[model samples]
Structure formats: structure tokens, C-alpha cells
Target chain A: MSAEIEDLLKRYQNYPNVVGIIILDPFAIPIKTTMEYTLTVHYAALISTLTSKAAKMVTNLDASNELMNIRLRTKVHEVIVLPSENYIIIVVQNPGS
Target chain B: MSAEIEDLLKRYQNYPNVVGIIILDPFAIPIKTTMEYTLTVHYAALISTLTSKAAKMVTNLDASNELMNIRLRTKVHEVIVLPSENYIIIVVQNPGS
Candidate 1:
């Protein structure tokens, strides 16, 4: 299993144009890392996946600055982004069943 | 939502003795960050969760260099630990259904 994990990490490390990549659990902890990942982007990705999925499964995504977000706060660990940017933030919920 | 994420990050950061904390997706990406997480330990957390779950659901976690591991390769990203060390590696499989 450890050998397999090494191989998997190498494969993801070679992602094209990647800067940093990280792997964590639902609570937002490190699982893996690559060039395409960083402290900032890692959280963004988790949030993005969680929020996006949660919106569909729990609520909905918003666009306007003053709009409602999904009910993913509980299911997800939480992620923060820039103050005034249109960068995508996605979140995915892991059903513990 | 953004504010909520910030609060969550701060709360986790305050974890006693936490070196760093990162949140990522199954693809081995990041979602959030804290103090008690690192590149190696983060991966360990993911692997630990994944392999543990996979072992129970697919196979089981072994404790020998020349032993068999679970069948979590497909559902998990991958994680590696020192060959000579018995550090825990957890992996969690997210059922796509």
C-alpha cells in the first residue's frame, strides 16, 4: 500500500501547469501535495468542490455579492478566498454513511 | 459563506500543538490549512482515513512489511510513510453513488 501511494503521488505531481496540489479529508487536513497545490489554493479547491456539490445536494451556489450560499457549512470544514475576486470556489460533501 | 470559512480556519489553526492543517479532495488536493499539518503528515491523514475505511469496506489494514494491504487503490489518491516507521496512514473512500 505504501509503495502504491508513492506511485500515485508521483503521477499527480506531474500534472501539466500545476503549481500545487494537496489531499485532505472532509475536515480539511493534508493528505497529499504536489506543485499545483499551495496553502491558499488547496483550501480553495476543497471549498470549491464542497460548495458546488453541496449547493446541488443541499442548497445552491450564488453569484451576486449579496446572495445566499448553500447549507454546506456543517458538512464541510470551511474555506476562504480573496476578498474581491471571481475565482471559483467549489465544495464536495462526503456522506459519512 | 466566506466569512464562515475564515472562522473555521482560525478555529482549526488554534489546535494545540498543531503544526499544520490542510484540506484537500480525493484527487490529493487541498481545501484548507492550519498549524498542525505538513506535506508528509497531511498525506498520512488522508491515507489513514482512506485505507482504514477501504480495509473495513474492501479489505483490511496490515502491520507487516511483507503483508497484504487493502483494496483502496481505486477509491483513494495514495499515501506513503517511512518504510522503517510504523506511522499511521489512513485513507477514506468516497462512494460516488
Candidate 2:
């Protein structure tokens, strides 16, 4: 799993405009992050909570539907979150770059 | 204020893909919604939480930056949240429609 994560990190880091990547456990604890420790932990916690809330919203609207992903765009960056059963991946990028 | 909300609702309802619109107070309480009552309340609570968490994440990354919007895409719909100082507007749309 560690090897796979390392490979994933390298691949995403090579992408254009990619700024940072964070891989978190099911509990939203950062397992691997290319960003500074403080910022990484902050993002891990908040993004996981956001993802869960979104999933709940989806389920409430339709019991059979599922949440695919979330794209949060701020003035400076675009944060994309992918939530799977095992882990959640957050990628922060500068879209204008 | 009520008249403005009614106009906003009417305008968004005429948009190409918009399915429902929800206007919420700063507290995430629904002020006006085109959706059913139960669904409106559900969306108001969860989306407000999502917006706040995302905003916090933005500020954490860069104290000077601000969160502009959030686009949450599920299998069936796209939920767009616009948060302002006084109100939050949520639009649920079928993008593939």
C-alpha cells in the first residue's frame, strides 16, 4: 500500500498546476502528504468532514444514489476530493497556472 | 428582501438545468426553497456545514484568500453552493440534462 501511495503521489505531482496531494485514512488522518505538516493536518480533517456531509446529503436526497466527488474552488485554488471506502485523496491545484 | 428572493428563485428556475433552488439564512435555516420541505431542510443543514468547512480549509491554506463556491457532483446531480455574508444560495441541477 505504501509503494502504491508513493507511486500515486509521484504521478499526481507531475501533473500540470498540481500544488499538493494528501492521502488520508478512513478516519481522515493524513497518511501521506506533500504539503507542510500543519497545513496537511488541517486539510485532512476539514475535507473529510466535508466529504461525509456531502455523502449524507446525497443519500438523504435519494437512498440509492452515491456521492462521486467534490470540487471546491476558492479564489486561489481548486481542491478536488475523492472519497473511497479505504482512503480519501485530496488534490490542491492552481487552475489558472 | 422577500421580493428579491422571489425574483432570484424565479430567475434560477428558468435556467437550463436547474432542478431546485434553496435560499438559507446565515444560520443555514431555509428561507425559501423550491424543493420539498424535508429535502430543503436536509440540504440547508448539510450544505451550510460543507460551505463553512470548505471556507475554513481555504483560509487555513492562505489567510488572505477566500472561498468563492463549491461544486458537489454526485451520480445524478450537481449541487452548487454560493455563500455570502447574509445568505447562502444552493442550486441543485441535472448537469447531464
Candidate 3:
């Protein structure tokens, strides 16, 4: 599942007039959670800035609740607004222990 | 309403082995909100640090299932987990606009 998303992101690089592209692991992803879409937008911006691509605009992450999460519970925090999303994008740090 | 909480905080100085004392405005209060109690606890610590009082201990805010908000809505965002507190201690910044 995560691999497939990465593959799709890679395809973004082949198109002409494209910018840099990278995928984010929503699993245990670190986020302020309530920044609406800024975090995702920033991720795209970071990708373009670090790589050689003619991209200056960020394509939106269509995080309309339908494409977030569907499995995992305590491993996933309580879904903040299931009325909005089936799965949640939780904020987790890199496992250090 | 807010005045009462401040008065109670002032009385804390009279008790021995107290640290700092300060009240928070749940309204338009700047907080990370999800820190559970750290932000509130820090407020007390900061108060004790500056004030000359026999306080080195902190108390808890009795924020259980009550004593929150009851009226505001859009002025308030949708209640996150009303399965818990009726009035949420929203992470609001000091209103400047």
C-alpha cells in the first residue's frame, strides 16, 4: 500500500514541466494534525525546493477523509473526526527505544 | 466567572509550600491543547517563579466532565470529544484580530 503510493509519486517526476516529488508515510506521520492542508502543501514545497524540477506549485493532497486510514487502532490514536475520515493520520515520532 | 478562578488562584499564596499561581482564560487562550495538563501546570510554575510566595508545589485543575463551556458554537469549533468535557479548553491564541 505504501509502496504503491511511492510508485505513483515517482511517476510525477516523468512529466514535463514537473517539479520535485516525494511521498510521505502517513503511518506514524508527525503532524500538528489541525493545520488543514498546510502540512501537505509544505511537504510538496520541500520536495520541489530540494530537487531539480520546474515546479513552483504544489498539487493538493486530496485528504478528504475517504483516503486516510481504515485499519489500526491503539497503534492508531483515536480517530479525531471519523465523521469526517474513516482512518486518521496520526502524529508519531520515530521509534527510538 | 473568570474572575472567580483568579480569586481562588490568589488564595493559593496563603498556603505554605506553594509555588506559582496563575489562571488561564479558556477563551482565546494560547495552548497546544493536546498536552492534557502540561500547559496549565506550566502556568502555575511560571506564576510561582516570579511571585514571592511560599509555594513550590502545584495543584490540579479539576477539569473533569464539567465546568467548561455550555453556550458557544461556531465561535467555538465543533466539540472534539464531548463524550468527555462539555466545554473544551480549545487551543486559542490571544484574540488580536
Q: DockQ winner among the candidates?
A: 2
TM-score of 3: 0.17
Supply every candidate's count of residue pairs whose N, Cα or C atoms clash at under 3 angstroms.
Answer: 57, 0, 9
Task: Please tell me how candidate 3 rates in CAPRI terms.
Answer: incorrect
- Clash list (residue pairs), candidate 3: A69-A87, B18-B54, B18-B55, B18-B56, B19-B48, B19-B55, B19-B56, B20-B48, B69-B87
Looking at candidate 2, what is the lDDT of residue B61?
Answer: 68
After the best TM-score superposition of candidate 2, give how far the Cα of residue A29 lies from its true spot, in angstroms.
3.3
Ranking by TM-score: 2, 1, 3
- Which candidate's lDDT is highest? 2
How closely does chain A match the true chain A in each prediction, as TM-score?
A: 0.36, 0.93, 0.25
Model 3 DockQ, alpha carbons vs. true complex? 0.01
- Per-residue lDDT tens digits for candidate 3, residues B1-97, read 5565444545544544333333433332322232336644543333222111101100111112121111111121211111111122322121123
The DockQ assigned to candidate 1 is 0.02
lDDT of 2 by residue, A1-97 (tens): 9998898788778867998999999998999999999999888878888789889878987898899889888888888888888889899999874
Span of ten consecutive residues with least summed lDDT in model 2 chain B = B7-16
- Residue A64 of model 1 has an lDDT of 24
